[model samples]
Target: MTPFVIVAPAGAGRVRLLRTGDDGLPFTGPDGSGLFGAAAAVTVEGSDLARTVAVLEQAHPRWVWDDTSRWYPSLLAAGVRVERCVDLRLSHAILRHSTLTQDSELAMSLPGVFTSVAQVGVPAPASAASIHTPAPHSTLFDDLDDLDELAPSSSAGFGATDPRHSDRIPRVNGTGGTGDTDGPELDAVTDETPELAGRDHSTEDPEPDTLEIAEFRRQRDAIRTATDPSRIALLVAAESAGSLVAAEMQHAGLPWSAALHDDLLTRLLGPRPPAPGIRPARLEELLASIRTLLDDPTVNPDSPAELVKSLRRAGLNVSSTRSWELKNVDHPAIPPLLEYKKLARLLTANGWNWVDTWVREGRFHPNYIPGGVVTGRWASEGGGALQLPKQVRSAVVADPGWKLVVADAAQLEPRILAALAGDRAMAAAGRDRDLYDGIVASGAVDTRAHAKVGMLGAMYGGTTGESGRMLPRLARAYPAAIKFVEDAARVGEAGAVVTTRLGRTSPRPSDAWQDVQDEAGADNATEAARSRARSAARSWGRFTRNFVVQGTAAEWALCWISAIRRRLWLLDASTLAPTARGGAAPTAPTTPTAPATDLRLEQRPHLAFFLHDEVMVHTPAHLAEAVAEELRDAAREAGRLIFGDAPVQFPVTVAIVDSYDQAK
Candidate 1:
């Protein structure tokens, strides 16, 4: 296959193209000037962009670009898609931070041009929400969604197996963080720098092309010499493919019903506020009811401090305004308070303001930040895509002739744990069955709830409450599974790093963490100091404990998405609409090969949304079943590729729905 490199907007509305070979060194022809070892330099402008891409597709050359977010959207808009690409920015982040590449000079250097993409790779710390909702009397529930209640928290060190946390730390190195917008992060270069025979690749600064090509070459070499080249190659390819999916999904945009969303908001929040910074009628009524129950009209429920004081005055004896805390209180005020909190969340998080900003031209185009979480789960920039409230899910409606096929892997993290540990008991429990149910059958716990809690505790270092109580039972039932995480925890407690299956390494403890450890060992350390040290150690242990399983699970998700994208393209596109209706559960295929599916990979039947283990594909209504089957097949393919003959199965629960609410 011919290898191609594309540089976007090489001035004058033209895109620069270069073709290379298997060696990856620039192509050099007999009469070539060899400015950058190019056999030829061609600029294709105007409508020829798509034509050029279409012609290049025939050769099937691997596209090389700085970032997919910047380049692929335009191609996708112009009705062109490529099979393979080399994402220099994404690969740079992986190679730069990878322990496997640490010995190399390029890897040993500080943050460079290539290092700007680190935010997309590493998970942010827990601090505050990047975008805070202005909810009055907001509780912990305000930040969580239905998924949070049903699944583990996605943040490292959190009391959950699949930790996905984000705390915005002010970044100083120009641009990067979980919140960084999608674009070409590389500096523009009009020409290539002179090739230096003895140049230090680790230098602080270099020309954009020089740094880009050097880092790309270094990463390629690192993977070639990797401990497991095949796995590393799979990982980089999957990661880069993820980049493509992210951009393409954004370009396609999630089909949203602005009218329906407006209706939902009006019914719930009592219409839009008459003016900016004003509460809607429904919210105001809830607030009034809350104050009446407290008998303090002067009290402000939005102010946590004022509300807590008011509740104490009302003789409620509540500790805080959080729903969970108030749930324990039997006061009549609790009900209204809960109602107020719920509506407040809806109005603030996904209300009219959100609709105006996010939903554009009947589509919600969320900016996907691939590899954003520390554990490798993706994040979003704007539109609160990750925090899709169930109340507003009704607005995620399919177009008139299309349907949304939503699929989520059943008990994904636990199954991932089973595969990672190669635990026969765990795998046997999870294979082709509900893992928690299988655990209950094994006599590990008395109930499904206990089984779930025990496994979560095992992976996330949950040694308190019901989770803590069930750990011993889990250990006895699945020794290998429990020991896998236990060993990782032990390593973390010793301040050692752990690597995911595909080699994404967890960061080491911070300097403060090390100081705490050292102080605990010093003779001058007080009991409080030792206590603090132990607490921090346990915290770090929780992170590493879940890191391997969570990170590996992320790898499985990437592979799953990549496979689905490829599979969606292979299906035959039909102009005829299938028999299934758009707004309900799609009908089963009448024949082995359903006729006139109207699912076109080049146009429709594309992925619209993904969150952790769940994916929503927007496809022609007729082809919903086919897309669902393809999703299932891709999941199986991802499992086989990632774990080979491992007994564990990644079970996907798929639904063909007209709106996202129907999927649930």
Candidate 2:
């Protein structure tokens, strides 16, 4: 049989077999519209290339050439004597002479590239032929030499059941070993507890395989250390400054306060603390401090001397000495002082007076309240919890025998923006992988860097006019997505609070706001100001539109959390042991499980840290992979539940690593 070649344009409706020319190669299709424009050609090489070509000719109707080497492997596996050949022109020169010289580079790169191309452009029909002849090799991956660098070794099998084997499950490091200083003995504590089921519980503890364990320890320790009463005090002070600013704005008849405070306390303190006794003089002092902070560029951390000098350009006279006084003063210095008092009182009631006595077994489990901010976000409690200080992350060390699993979502908000907007162009941009890259490809913007800045500004209510202007352009380019935000904004302007798919409601507008709007009709300067206040009120309403998307995103986060928690509980005790061969080393167990050790859903993996759309968990090393899988599955399920698997798609990026910082 003469060797032949098959070629198909990317979006072509059919595949065709062409007679090999004198050069013994297929001709490149003409460059134009239709299949020729959409796709390239396919090339096959091997001992029996002619047989492989015959098989392809038989299956021509269903075949598509997404790339040059798409079907080479599958044909070879089906008893056809063909192999994928790498076109030297396309191969990296440096890699061509390296350890990969003998491998079929075309076989390696084709699948990923083809899968990507197929998703865009157009869909092709599946082959209708019923050729079922099995190849001499039982496995499709018979050409192990071609993918030796990519494949797992005998000692690194992924689903090995032996306690001494590393490949019992998918591990971040490929080796089952968790690079934790503490050994696998911690599996016992995790295994015996029903709450920690779905976790690997092998008796043979493994040593650290990667820096992931150390990173996790660092993050865990950081969380533990930050929870110290003093640290919490500092955070509360900063957070209170934000709150006090809102309150002062409210008192001064500014409408922003209601929006800023919107259900924040209810989410944080749980039903809100009883209205505190308001000392008019004390409240006045706190308000003044906040005003000073907002007005004075010198007092703000991001302010530069030049910027401070420029504050007058914006029509504000703030003194440097006033900024210094606010920072230097302790008890009497405005909002921080009042916040400290309130936080101190709460700590006392919780029996956390002394820092040493407050922590439980060197672990501090902070409460992560979802939708805590009116913007549909999360807030933390207990330790310097919600907005963690970077300096303190080092304190989140691992427990004596355990490790931490840090995972996060990448480009979450922008992806959410794509879903909400239903902009096919934007959605198509994201379909290929990176959102920023997609934007660049669209040619709607100049560069990926600018696209990033514009998208972020649009979501956060970009103050600079540049972002606002660019946003309309983006909306014009992708009407569906832009309309999503516009519709939400319209609802918010009508004074309606948006709700999540799961029924979590946005805080209702305060009655004071209603009064202000009602009084705007009166003929007075106050009424004119009221009209301006109403305009300002629209910002929060805008926030609510974003809040719905953001809050629902939070719900997805919790779903991932719940899934990981459950999967960890299902792992058997024996599966977590160190592999006997080139396997993960075993670490010594540090914390012994007591008879009363009870793992609750809330306690299984300590949620030590959270930022916007990501979370960090500290668990026994044996349960790390299970936790990672659960996180991914849960996120997907949550998306389906919230958006219904329809016009919108929600995808999550999750990675399990030993260290908290490494996860980032």
Best by lDDT: 1
235-259 in candidate 2: lDDT tens per residue?
Answer: 1222222222112111111001121
- lDDT score of residue 630 within candidate 1: 92
Task: Work out how many backbone clashes candidate 1 has.
Answer: 9
In candidate 1, stretches whose alpha carbon ends up further than 4 angstroms from where it belongs are 4-15, 28-50, 117-209, 576-602
Model 1 residue 653 CA deviation (Å) reads 0.9
Segments in model 2 whose C-alpha atoms lie over 4 Å from true places: 1-360, 368-371, 374-376, 522-530, 576-612, 646-658
Best by TM-score: 1
In model 1, the clashing pairs are: 123-374, 136-302, 137-302, 154-163, 154-164, 154-165, 155-163, 155-164, 155-165
